[model samples]
Target: MISRASLRFSLGRFTTAEEIDAAAAKLVAVVTHLRQNAPAFEFD
Candidate 1:
């Protein structure tokens, strides 16, 4: 779902401050993109 919805954001390998910050930025970007572009996906 991450790959299908996000812009090639790779996760699960962050251990430094820069990497964590980048991950957070990527996450925000993904959520914003999905909110404005992708259809709403609700969990049941």
Candidate 2:
């Protein structure tokens, strides 16, 4: 059988544990990249 649903926000739907882990790794890399490229704040 197949499953499906509708939601307000669709981030994603992982079918297996491995898929979730892969997504987590990618998320970490994205966060690291964002932190590295984030704009610096300056106040006068």
Best by lDDT: 1
lDDT against the true structure, per candidate, is 0.67, 0.61
Predict model 1's lDDT versus the native.
0.67
Query: Which digits, one per residue and each the tens of the lDDT, describe model 1 over residues 1-44?
Result: 43344356556654687887888899889888766775555421
Candidate 1 residue-wise lDDT at 3: 36
Model 2, position 18, has a per-residue lDDT of 86
Error of 1 at 13 (Å): 10
Cα lDDT tens digits, model 2, 1-44, are 22223435245564677876887799779877866765555111
